[model samples]
Target chain A: MDLSFVIFVEVLYGVASLVLISAGLAVVFGMMKVINLAHGEFMMMGGYATITAVGYGVNVFVAMLIIAPLVVGLIGLVVERLVIRHLYGRLIDTMLATWGLSLVFIGLATMIFGNTTTGISTPIPGFAFGGYQVNGYNFFIIIVSILLVITMYAILRGTRAGLIARGTMQHSDMASALGYSSDRIYMMTFFCGSALSGLAGAVLAPLVGLVPTSGGAYIAKAFITVIAGGPSLIAGLVSSATSFGLVSQFFTFTISPVIGEVALLIAAVILLRTMPKGITGRFFKGKL
Target chain B: MSRRASQDVTITLVVSAFLIWFLPLMISTYTLTVLVIYGMLGLSLGLIWGFGGILCFGQAAFFGLGAYTYAITAINIGESTLPMILAVLVPAVFAALLGAMMFYGRLTDVYLGVITLVVTLILFKFMNSTAGPQYAIGNARLGGFNGIPGFQTLNVPGDPSAYIWGDTYFYVCALALVIVFLLVTWLLRSSFGRIAVGIRENEVRMGLMGYNVAARKTMLFAIGAAIAGLAGALFANWGEIVTPNLFSLGQSAEIIIWCIVGGLGTRFGPIVGAAGLAYLKFMLGQQSMIDNTLIMGLILVLFVLFLPRGLVPAIETLLNSIIGHKKRKPKPHRMRRARHG
Candidate 1:
């Protein structure tokens, strides 16, 4: 029972973090079709923000939940204005441009923090679950991911802003015809996407050592999740993340973590080849 | 061809020939040979990306594959020719398989880029983890992070013991670079090359016009991979060591930067871009005044934003304006259908 329960938590933890890392990309790339290659870098920045804030004696949760998002969101706003605004529909160009942005972020981070690995200890201590020692922090990540999903769902589904954002994403010209400014919507959406990325990075910072190019590690997984999720926003993200996360963790538990990573990639390749449009592209068609 | 076009070609040929024959005497063998390697790598990428419009982000995978193949084969076979052939063949086959999956599966451009990048990262990760004794390919021990070293290098085709090194190696590489350049130039002017370029401009349109779009793209990709493999083979011999860093994201990014900076889709662009950027990088390494990564990032951002046409096309436009259309200028492929007032 303890082993199964531990396995369950590990799988959930994997899924949750996958959801967290890919959420921002779902909005920015999936909705906006912007193909932001610098997404991992944004997450990196978020991690840095939380760390720096914690270093200055801010509460870890507060630094992660509020300050990191705000800092990264603001940076996103600046980036959107200066760079992304110019390459709205040019998908390939945006990829190249944001790739450059990612490099810049990594470089700047390296310059400021040096190329050393740094991290803070998990705020929550381990607790015994029956005979096994369970990481109490895993529960925190699970809860955070759940809350994030709810927030994104509520805002994108229930709110007026959400409707406008959806409308803008689906048909910017049509939305513009209806008296909504596409530029404002795009900027605000990018800001939110960036904030979400920041939040994901900040929340996960304690789990792993942070380095300047740490973003590169996250990029492939995030992209795989988002792309494999396909056209549907929330549904696709959830489904693909669930599947990939499970497969990776399964391999991790059974054989080794390195094999798990390889399994995830192989799964992606097979998944992409079979269903070019993605899991959501096939199953959750017309879903939000 | 017109008089001006033939004249331009002859002049270019003469200049390149002179540079190949003369420059090796003046420059250090190390610098010239390394430049040759980048030039070859850039040439392959330039063909695929510039002409074929397949913007691969993981081209270093082929380069690394070729190097590894050569290293392993040369070690076992105790000869250069077979390993050299394998070096090119290995990457070409890998590329063909990968490209068929990507292009035939009708993957969108974005996903294609993502998938290629992931493949590269996978190769890097897998290679890095192969430090254990279990990971052996025949006679060559696949050294993980430490990489394989002291592999048999290039020599006379018939003789195994007669090894080529230093200036002789440099000259061979220089000659190879020039030959590849000329070969690429000839290929670009061929009917098949036109089809590849046309596909880049409009894939569906070409598909509709009864062309085997995917097959052509796969061919182009394979050819590009073969050249990159050759470059990698040379690089392994030049560096006398092969590390997993050869397949790194940084290396991939550098390849892309070279193609972009030199001039994507142009014959001479990749060579110039690779040579120029590699030199700039070497210089930056020697200096401590500025951060190299930061500058590279800045260059990427700035170049994309302001100089998307890259150095070559930008210069062409500038020269055209200066001469005020005194001669009939050849328009780059991007200019649509000769728009006249």
Candidate 2:
């Protein structure tokens, strides 16, 4: 019974983190349709930002939630103006350009942070649950993700700005015809997407040691999650993340993490095969 | 074939011939061989991405497969011939399987890129972790991150005594490069190439016109993979090591960079892109004032934004504007028609 409870939490934690890792990408690639290959790099920057801010004596929560996102979001904003703006409709071009940008970001990060893996000790220590001791950070992650989902839901479904963002994404020409500036909308959406990526990175930094190339690992998984999620934004992200997280973690606990990672990929491939339009594409139809 | 198309083919053949003769005196055998192999890698990607409009982000997956296949097979068999065939066949077969899944599944372009990249990562991660003794295939140990080394290198077919090395190896590889280039050129001009280009231009239209778009794409993808595999096989012989890094995202990204920077859609563009950029990178590595990544980033951004046609196409456009009124120059669409019409 205790083992099952611990397993449940582990699965939840997995789903939560996957959601967190892919949320920013969901916003960017899911809605904006800009394949931000440098997204993982942005997350890396976010991790660096949180670490730097924390070193400067900022509160960890503040560093992660506020400072990291702000820094990465600003970078995203600049990237939007400089690169993404030009290659909005051109899908393949954006992939190549952003891949270059990803390389640049990795190099820059390496120069600043050095190539070695650097990380902070987990703020929330391990606590006993029956025979097992769970890292309290897992709970924190779960809570943060729950909060994240709620916030995303509120912002996207409830707010006028969310409506505008959604409107612009669906049909920019139509949005422009309604006297809204698509450029500003795009920039702001990219900023939000970037900030979310940073937040994910910052939050997860303590869990995994941060290195210059740490982003590379996340890029594939985040992309898989976002792409497999399909079109219905929040619903797709949550649903796919849940399914994948459960599947991967179940395999991780049953076998090994290597097998787990492989399972996720295979699952993604299978997911994509059956539902080429993605899970949400077939099921959700129109729900945000 | 049209007169102009044949003329361009002849020019390519002549250029290759000149290079086979001229390159030996100008550059060292080592550099020449490396450049030739890199050019082959770039050329394959140039065909898939530039012509077929299939941007495979993880091309190094096939390259790595070829290298590992060659290195392992060479170690076990102790003969270079089977390993060489295995090198090309392994990647081609793998690509055929992968391409079938992707193309037949009706994957959109972005998903294709993502799925291919994931596969490469899967290989990289899988190989990186295989440090144990159990990872050995027959007599050849994977060696994990350290890679598989000390394999029998490429030699003259059927002769185990006389090894192909140094200038002889360079000449042989250069000849192979020329042959591969000419073969690709011929393929590009064939009926199959036209249909592939047509599908790239408009998949829906091609599908409507009774072409099995998916099968053609899969075959083209396999051909490109075979080319990449050939490059990988040469690379293994040149470097004498097959590391997991061959499947790395960095390696894959570099291949794409070569295709882009050199120019796309032109026969000579990838050769220029691969050779020129390889030299530039080698030069930059000597000093390294600014980061190479930064330089690469700026080049990619600049190219995409300012010069989308790449160096070769851009130069061709300039030549067309300046002194060439009668020159039936290669516009993308006309090149499309020239290849298959």
Candidate 3:
């Protein structure tokens, strides 16, 4: 393959990854007021689960299917009940508490797994599509992310649960007064957000090798995306992620990755200042 | 005069001065050095969070910036003291600029925290990645994963004293600590300090009173950054190494934890917090087999939930209770009966 062609393929993959992860985060943030600082940690947990499953002589794809989201979701539920539940309405306390929780989780993971990078075996060995040599595992991730997005959007907009969740987001007290169980909705939303983060981790584990500290890398970028896209708009987050990914990739190819990340962040900050409510906010200003 | 109401300001000053003068002789060099460094960091956080009510989670950015500035400039200039000054100045200026932008933009407390965090993270990533050939700075290589080393030591010109090591250096550090602490205390007691308190209490009221709340906040942030930068410079000179880890979220969280654990609004709370936590971590490190962080996390959770007022206030209340106070004199019986009727 030519050099330019390879770059194009790489850029496409980057854009796809950012969009998938950002969309998942947006859904969670929109529904639940909690900004999960340990979101990336959930992804890390999922990655570890995938690797562990593979190590146990399980079929890579099957192991990821069973282990990734389930383990991540379970951990998320526990975190919600034990720690995150105490953090609602209080932003600073929540941020500090979750940050400390992240550190503890990281320390535990480091102790158990040791400080080394581990890679999972590709789920579909020798899988290829046309001249583009697709990793069947990554393709599966993309498909799953797309399906998840579709399902989340449908559930958010078309179902009773979706309406209740939206009502809670708009006005928590009013939702409760209307006889809907806000607590249950909150729990479900937290579970779904964490599960999506886990799914991202499980799917990306094979693509990006797993390390104990790897989760820290994605967190700042995810935060930027969420803020720039406006935490309330899923479509805005998806678009922002795609744009950021493309910009990052283009800059990485032309200048350097480090410079690219810096540029993206600077741009994101500037954009945030200019458009505090994000693209969707700008477009739907009158109605929203 | 009421005995409890008597001012002991002179005695307090004399005692503090004596401690400042004699701390090196009283403690081991290691202990003295750690206390000085941690105390300085604690003061910085206290100024920012306690006075300004800005819960910054990324003072480590300024800390790392100061260290790097000192290290790089020292290497280039072939002198320690000048570079150290430059180090503190650079981070302070950077912080001032960032603060101005954030404050003027009208970002609230939470957004301010997020912006600082994002900036620090970006700096961390940039430094972490640019350690290779493309970003090398002379023989002091950025070294990506390895970090910069062999930083110059602070020097005093022509005193025939030579550069001190161990206890002597600890004495110098303690002296610096005393000076900075006094300066901070004075600042906090000044008119500007009262305005800062007013800003914290009701910024809208302060604004309506024409206090320029944003400018005050920005200035306070800059002052805090300068102090943090000073600590960073001292740390680099003491440790003789600078790394991207200094800018990490872990370091920032540690600073916030120190401030929270000590006492929020009290003068010595951060000092106590930093020293106590550092001592605990050091002791835990010695144990080797135990998971120290788990214990620390539990303590933090307990403190946040139960002892939210922090250790200093709790201690003060306990002391006040133990001292035994006189009961108030009863009101006139006739007046009391009339009031009741």
* Model number with the top DockQ: 2
lDDT of 1 at A63: 97
On TM-score, the stronger of 2 and 3 is: 2
Specify the CAPRI tier of model 3. acceptable
Between candidates 2 and 3, name the one with more favorable lDDT: 2
By lDDT, the best candidate is 1
Each model's TM-score, in the order given?
A: 0.96, 0.96, 0.89
lDDT of 3 by residue, B155-199 (tens): 774332355567777777777777787777778777898798777
Interface RMSD of the candidates, in order: 6.0, 5.4, 11.3
DockQ of each: 0.49, 0.51, 0.26
Q: Clashing residue pairs, candidate 3?
A: B131-B144
Residue by residue across A1-288, what tens digits does model 3's lDDT show? Answer: 555665665666676677666554666666665666677777788899988988888787776766788888888889888877876776566566666666676767777888788987666665444565645555565567667667877887789888788889888899999998888878888887887788778888887878777877666677678766764455766667777878888888799877788878777767666666665566534221
Per-residue lDDT tens digits for candidate 1, residues A1-288, read 889999999999999999999999999987688878899999999999999999999999999999999999999999999998998877877777898899999989988999899999999999998999999999999999999999989999999999999999899999999999999999999999999999999998999899999998888899999989999999999999999999999999999999899999989988998998889889979989
Q: Please, what are the lDDT tens digits per residue for candidate 2 over residues A134-210? A: 88999999999999999999998899999998899889999999999999998999999999999999999999899
Residue-level lDDT tens digits of model 2 in B229-331: 9999999999999999999998898888888887888878888888888877777787745777778777877887887678997887787889867866545
Clashes of each: 1, 1, 1
Choose 1 or 3, whichever is better by TM-score: 1
What TM-score does model 3 achieve against the real structure?
0.89
Looking at model 3 chain A, report the run of 10 residues with the lowest lDDT sum: A279-288
